[model samples]
Target: MRRLFTGLAAGFLLLGTAACGSSDGSGASDAGAASGGTTTLKVGVIPILDVAPVYLGQKQGFYAKRGLKLQLIPAQGGAAIVPGVVSGQFQFGFSNTTSLLVAQSKKLPVKAVANGVASTAEDGADFAGITVKKGSPLTSPKQLAGKKVAVNTLNNICDTSIRESVRKDGGDASKVEFVEMPFDQMPAALAGGQVDAACTPEPALATVKAAGGKSIASNFFDVSPDLTVAMYFTSQQYAQKNPELVKRFQEATIESLKYADSHPDEVREILTTYTKIPDTLLGRLTLPRWPAEPDRASIERLARLAQQDGLFKQSPDLDKLLP
Candidate 1:
């Protein structure tokens, strides 16, 4: 967990400027040189169901057809990926809306390129949920107050959305204690009573559910039925310098998102390629909505909720942030 914060801090320190590592206008890694003949771009991604589309797209040759290749690096969360993208360690990254908003508030030179994922918007049936052990007495989001809740990262999307759920249930969100744990570790932690609850997304959500965990609320749904949970992004410098490559990436990604949205079985099969999610759970896990573009209204609503929760130091400028 220390690596999560350390890597982000290092990213900020390593890249004093957006053009720190690059010397020319191609805005590519040294490995992506002409010597290789194929432009392979590194992208930092989280190991979650939300990122399944890009993998599917890659397998489907969307990026290859665009004369690009992806080297997806599994990151703990946006804490690392944000800085990785900004520092040029990754040409692109996947991050939640609030974390991107928080990065924007800090004046980080980053911009979202395409929609990553969204909520199913079905009450108690969304892709991610706030879950407690089945035998636990807690049956509502309001009960999260005065209890410890585990989130992948603190002050980012997981906690921010959970706070909204608690507040919507008429509970004081501030009273909730958020414990920082990786998504993979959450199932065991919740089962062992290491935390009172967890904000889990599939297939971890599926694992917890298989363990008899009962979801009390759909946090993303509680925030907004149209909430744009996450998106694919790149450093502003990378976007500015590599306009053509970025355009190719955007086109490929949007196609990938659309393809994944319509093909559920392919997505389940692709999960086996990068993650260790079991076959039995794959059939039961709820997949997120993959919209070709983000919902600006939902993002705006999240910005307002982030403000209410004190996650941002300054207002998020959507015009410059969104694609």
Candidate 2:
């Protein structure tokens, strides 16, 4: 299996903080001074709009008002982001619930304190789906047996969702081959016929759809209804050391979400500044909802799935990982 971080450093350069919502450690707000002279927050994020609240907060001066200086690191995927938080490279990182739950189940020591986003079948909700070439005979998950499928990573949300989706359709997941393809490369890979199917999130999903590919299965809500698909997670040590900062960060992020909800076009403009994806693609992308309250049940289901997949042999105590 190819390590997910292989292309991350270069990928970061391509999509690194241009229209960034990240702070540069400068003290610019009264709320920030109350927390500390400069409450520096290093964050890991993917390019998708689920973290729009954080970006909105940064743009709207919420973080500044709280006196927090945020340094945003655009992570390659959930697998790479989890290690960054566990090792203290980032005070907090955005990740899919599956990856964080798996790490926590295996004793990596992390906690998810805020709600992220959920992928419903709504018009703008970005979820994972199996995409095949337009003319391919494979139109259903059951037809994927013994074929190659690409995911951002194996043993993570993309893979877990794909597998569960196949099982639901009476297909043997073990009989199929899983490949690792980054979001940027998936389109070309599919166009070149490198893989029969690809599992991805938007705007990559939109990219595939635009490339004349068809979706066979979409499992964002089906696999786990009201699931906390992705969220902001941190080490317990950070929370213990900076409870006030964490609270302020959450407040700023929530405020940002509200702003983005009211100003979708402006948020898309902000996204183009930070991501390699163009504004037109951003317009077609499906974004997740930013909730204020963290959902405990969705997180618990993540732990259970991780154990079932052998990502962990035993369940880690949930109390140690909650705020």
In TM-score terms, candidate 2 sits at 0.84
TM per prediction: 0.93, 0.84
User: Tens digit of lDDT per residue, candidate 1, span 177-280?
Assistant: 99998898998999899999998998889998999988899999998988899999998888877777888899999999999999999999998888778898
Model 1, position 293: C-alpha lDDT score: 88
Candidate of highest lDDT: 1
Provide backbone clash counts, one per model.
0, 7
Per-residue alpha-carbon lDDT of candidate 2 for residues 1-323, written as tens digits (9 for 90 to 100)? 12433433433443334314222222223345564575678788987666666876787888888777678888667877776665556778888877776667656668886767776645224455688877888987877789998877666787777776777789886677889867767877888999998887766777787778867887665466666787787777666666777788877776776777677677667777666676557767666556666567766776776666566676867677655
Give per-residue lDDT, candidate 1, residue 79. Answer: 65
